[model samples]
Target: MKANQPMVKVISSGKYAPSTLITNEDLERLVDTSDEWIVTRTGIKTRHRAVDETTSDMAYKAAMEAINRVNYDKDKIDLIIMATITGDQMTPATANFVQAKLGLNHEVMSFDINAACTGFVYALETAASLLQTGRFRAALVIGGEQLTKIVDYTDRNTCVLFGDGAGAMILEPSTHERNQAFFFNAARGDTNNTLTVVNHIKMDGKRVYLFAIDAMEQAIRKVLESSGLAIEDIDVIIPHQANERIIQSVSKSMGIPMDKFMLNLSEYGNTSAASIPITIAEYYDQNEVKNKKILLVAFGGGFTWGSAILQL
Candidate 1:
């Protein structure tokens, strides 16, 4: 069999959501919003809040679970790529903190990437590519965020739409044809600043909605085409849990069924970079996933969007 460019197999997966819950009813007190309105609009009922935890904390917790699930040797993880907008600090990359928490005192290639909500897809592609180089054996890919720290409670539109959590996957290069991976990551710059997170998150909801639908559709189609796989070939699609409406629109437009997409935004709202991996971890937890071909798609703040097709 021919070797693929981005070929990495998942050894284990895990996720960490803070215990604290922020329900729509709780948001009604913070801003001018109702449970019915929030649910009808975003399909989100509640989101997790990391009260005392930082992004790196959630990342470490999630990574530990993934490692322990298979009892994988910590030394095998020679590469660590974390995708997040919120880090514990400015200088030390969040991946560094996660590497420390994982107790890897040895030299490991670790770093962080911020492509916003589509970050996990970007990081997955990066790690997969790096693993193919034969320099790294196993890679820890994580998507984590503490979005609430950067959200403004006064803004009803953005405030109710984010949460805090982390998800991780342990991957290693695989020569097996079944484990071949394909990805497409691209971005359209937000010149108008349709969505921006400087001190806090600010967004034009209408513009983002329109862009998300188009971007997600493009990514899904591109990855499928590049992988030579049709929609039916995919067992499930793990889309960014940003909005149920956006997923629904993509489903309807693409002639794909809604049930084919894994959704958990009702329990955890847009976790920024963490959404896709969290959905992937939760999906694996609920189902028997083996040799399953999955498609991941996401659209984010950089006007960034990407997709990946891989087998489990």
Candidate 2:
């Protein structure tokens, strides 16, 4: 609502998951877990596996789909932000590889953000701030992850909870007054290593579950209060696809109906940063989202958590 603040709008979105499907039955062959157990605990029946695809490969595919959705001029896109913990290389940022694959000839500000599951929300807030300066016209914000590569198939605890996928959205300056977006991001340094991925995805499930519920409630309340909107005013909520219990807990605690939340973790498990955008893109593909109020929230490793509200 500041006089000089520019409004940012999402022009289009796209999502992509690997062709390989790993059902709970497939997991039974590798780990000592059952379909009923996985479903009862995590609500994950199946997830996608990236056979030979790199993080950048999926990111590029997702970006192209988003770009093509609006016939956006790639030449005019001045910024590219990719959110992922699983990069093909540890040196150059994954955003650089995505730019090259997209065949963008001009110089643009390209970088990667690693906030774990909250990465996409962080990237969106960062891009929106830059665009608000009127220096950047358009930005391609992508969240992609190949978690299956790092997952320990033998460890049933973390193995069945991750999948591979990518999602992308184009952000541009908006003229509509109601199209403005608001964001709230926060983080906690996990010195105790409650959740981390140094060698592989290792987490204390009980600790993470407790943290997730608190973070979700705090973020949702903070965004709603800051935006001067109530829970009833929001149309849809796209939360990180981590666990079914975490979301259900938050819903019960907040007294919100589960139907208001968009979820695809049952099919894709937790794709980390890719969850929210992937769900949003897929939902938009099937439903009309124009001028509707949307809320996005996530909690991830690094103890990072955040929420964003925007109109599509």
lDDT of each: 0.93, 0.92
| lDDT tens per residue, model 1, 158-263 | 9999999999999999887778898999997789999998999999999999999999999999988888888999999999998899999999999999999999
Which 10-residue span in candidate 1 carries the lowest summed lDDT? 1-10
How many angstroms is residue 156 displaced in model 2 relative to the true structure, after the best TM-score fit?
1.3
What's the lDDT for residue 287 in model 1?
Answer: 90
Q: Report the C-alpha lDDT of model 2 over 121-150, residue by residue, as the tens digit.
A: 999999988998878889999999999988
Structural similarity to truth (TM-score) of each candidate:
0.98, 0.98
Steric clash pairs (candidate 1): none
- lDDT of model 2, residue 231: 89
